[model samples]
Target: MRKTLLTIAATCMWLAGTTAFGQGKTCEEAAPWSNMAMVMDLASYADGGAWYKITPTANSMLPFSLTELPTSAVQVFKGCNGEKALVMSEEVASGNISYYIESGVEYMIKLDVSQATGSFVMAMATPLDLSNAPDGNYCVKPINASVGMYSSIKANRPTWFKVNIVYPGMYSVGSGFSVPAEGAAVTSVKVKSGDCGAVENSSNLLMPNQVYAKAGENFFCVTCSGDMKVLFQMVSPVASCPNHPERMTALSAGVEVTYPNAVYENYWRFIAPETATYQILDKAPQGTILQVGTLDENDDAKFFCNFENGLMAEVDESGEGKLLVDMQAGQTYVIASETFNMLAEGVPSVKISKDETGVRSVSGSSRDIKVSKVAENEYRVSSYLLAEGAGVYVYDMAGRAVSSLNVRPEGDAVTVKLAGVPAGTYMFLIVGRSKSASTKVLVD
Candidate 1:
């Protein structure tokens, strides 16, 4: 999986071809600097370091890396919004992180400088040559086996991969590997036997230590008792010809969905625009069991929760589909569906909608506007002092402006009793010469 690599920090002060040098290192000083290439001599600071704040380009996969001059004294922390951060130390040298930094969002990188021999360099990796494939498994035998090319742990059993060790010297887990299990480390990586039988010629290699092997075809099986993420590593110099990894194309909210008519299984993805309860309605009678869950960067289902409430249908009866979920903002939700038997026609199409009654604000505007449901399918929009060019407009839950509420000022406050739209909740947008505001109004 090709994820946005964003593990890095830098504050630039460039003079065309000139670089800024620093000695007194402290995060308090570096906190205010803009993201640019910088060099600091941490040898003078002794144990002091600085924090580099980076607000990367939105929706871009920024690949960044850091390399210490002599020793590994850099502790990089990843966090935001005053949350406890996951710290990385060992992966700084000759390692990288790909992150999709949201546009105009600030990320803090705290640098804890320790064993600085003399001086060190820090640079934000920009203009990445992504024409190279990402780091992962390559050149394997038996291309049809699920256990051949980069295998994920299935249950508590060991997974195996056979790599043609042409330039084999040492192999260890790379920086792209994930280890979420508490205290989860490489247990034992050694040669595996053919078929479902005893062990063949095997040599166990513990993690953090690269194992040496002769140049030939080698078979290795990774066995970790506890559940953890693992990947194949080619620590030797022969690792080349990288292919750009396949990425998941995410679906955005508030858009009509296209029904999938696959024979057996169907898959989809969506990104929640905000924290709200969303409904996926089945529009046909195929009796499809809809399942929603979280997908890892590999687009693999990680975990799924029971629906708080979902509509059920009989074998041939129509389904009043309603799968409600509290989706978190910016999180990706995976959707999959299955049925007792495949249906060639009338394979239900799904629709997603959010309840607008509790919708606080969509567009963040400063103008004070009030909205209230008065009668069935009627709403009253009022403003104390309207801007010169202030105009009130009504929009459906999908944000398509349906009607305009023309409010002639009565006195100090301006009120418009408008109705005659479809029965449902609607969002009111007030746009003026100098400002704007959004409010929700419900109609029975």
Candidate 2:
């Protein structure tokens, strides 16, 4: 969906008052939840007659008090078998809500409270994992929000190997391989001539890569007489590797081996060079999920995604994260379930450099730009800069600003600090005494 700031604001308002939405398919549906992608909404309510945002713990239950229950809080429920359930007690005064989801199905609960009315109606601002629901039946009888579930990803094949030939010249054929996520490990790489004659067998030579695919086209040698196919295999004990973020199924392929003294960048663009499309992918920890609810005031609920807790992408209620990423025209992306909130909303782009000519040296004074997170509840902001006194902040998909540091001209070096931050994309800005220059940074 093409989200706008207004849309986010509206969603937040909805969450503040009530909670409704689940993350996966009903028993009538079948799929591995949302493939590790997610779509989220916000909500809020009053507590002890005082309004505050509610944060769910790893256990799938909400902390509540009779003194905090109000008519403005919206409550949602679902069946244990992934079936949609009705709101048992329509009154917001009810202190607790419930749901029932079946095994193998994922559900998302949303609570938007931007409106503080004492009543709420059943409405869906967004759908969680409805597209790929598993087959079954279930009901919602008031499930705890803190319950945790174990989930796994089905192994497939390698994605692709993107090899960029930096040096330009001649290329030859050697041995190579690729690996899929949590499958088998490559043991060796071997190349052969047209008649199965061994051309190269690699035992001492080692390729550090685990996975690779062709970006566009494959390469071949000009002197090769006929077509030659390279074969690869891997070995691994069943369940030898635990559920690891970096584990993968490994394979190998043949590449044009360059001479020891050759000066060339010519290389083959190998596509699907692995046994299959089972590449290493990050999965959410057991019991991690997103619910749609609002603050006590019926305002939007604000939350963040964290790798520390298995959240891949997070953004504030302003839809700023969607803006930071390059969006496509007509592609689907996961928001609150998995896949770092998959986003295929815009056309893919590559940053290119152009020749530049300007004053070689420029000098200016130093100034400290004070910055802090919006709240202790806010996600870590990854990068912060002063865009002409207008601070430009960057956060992870989890909505935490990863970097926030003061920047000012001091001699030739610009002052920058990257503390308490994780590796990800970031935006930076520096407002000079008059103009401002903004740039992107990759903290890898």
Candidate 3:
């Protein structure tokens, strides 16, 4: 699943393109600069040095400038708004964070830490001066399967974050390899296994909400007890998709969608100025229909019910015998259709009524109607009495039965006075000899 990515910083100067330089002679010599790139084995908890740091093939760190803030600083400004921020991480233990001299003004400058401990670089809106900023450095404190780090800035900006525990399970690191637990509710991911190589090239190219691991590393392994659980040390939310993944076609509108159908007087639907088209699609143990309709005209806005398949299902769309209808707003109309064994991709059709003022539809599918306000404070119950004799029940939203009524109504109609009911929303059910129908209604 793909999600929208948001820029979390405001300083544009930090993001400005900088010429790539080579790593300096040593930490003693280059301690004043930020480390551009490195890969570490976070799983090695035995020795803090077990995590190896690689010098950048070329220096990618943005040099601190005084003329104007770097575009990358924009991220710091946005992080203050309560969104997550990316900070810088160090691979070596003795590296020092050095500040450069600029103008006479002092500013707090640094990366913002994410919920995960990993450091990220982003642009910030505020221009921070390093010349007078406080002099404080931070480091990652490692513990077995537990992540911890400390950070501080000259001012109130959140400069540090850390994870308390890291996963310590064996996992398989390869393409198309997934390490999900059985029945575990999958909420988010930081990487896809197949795209490991791309992550190495550009750390920002990983997908959001994915599980990721370093390529060619022991991504997964088994415990001595033979129980297997995938262990991930830490994951960053920064996702980079170079290909610009495909767009998802959501179910905006389509036929055969699972929905309640209650049209006028139990017929399918009818039309006048509107158009509708219904076709029987699948019928194995049961028969299902797919209907597509549109508006015919802008003036006429009422739907009719044939009472068989449907009666005059008129809508605004132009065309004959179509399901789509355009009716004036705010009109009361009645639609009727049968309930099904289960709510599959198919449901009963919707019914609308025609009026000169506006159009209104029936109160959807109702197996039973829990009348909350039949007469002011008093309430009555009713439902679509399709079967000759059906058991009807009414309940509140809390699943408590409000009333019970047996019905042998005259042709799909039942009117029972609910005595002393409160004003609220209620649910109703109509149970046939074997099947049942249900719907909700509000009583003012």
Q: Best TM-score goes to which candidate?
A: 1
Candidate 2 per-residue C-alpha lDDT over 274-354 given as tens digits, one digit per residue, 9 for 90 to 100: 222111111222111111111111134422212232212222222121111221223111222211111222221111111
Model 3 RMSD in Å is 28.1
| lDDT by candidate, in order shown | 0.44, 0.25, 0.28
Residue 336's lDDT in candidate 3: 23
Models 1 onward score TM values of 0.24, 0.20, 0.19
Question: Taking the tens digit of each residue's C-alpha lDDT, what string does model 3 give over 171-277?
Answer: 22111234434442212222211111111111222322123232222111111112122234344322111111111111211333232221111212223333332
Higher-ranked by TM-score: 1 or 2: 1
Candidate 3 wrongly placed segments (more than 4 Å): 1-378, 382-429, 434-442
> Model 3 residue 38 lDDT?
21
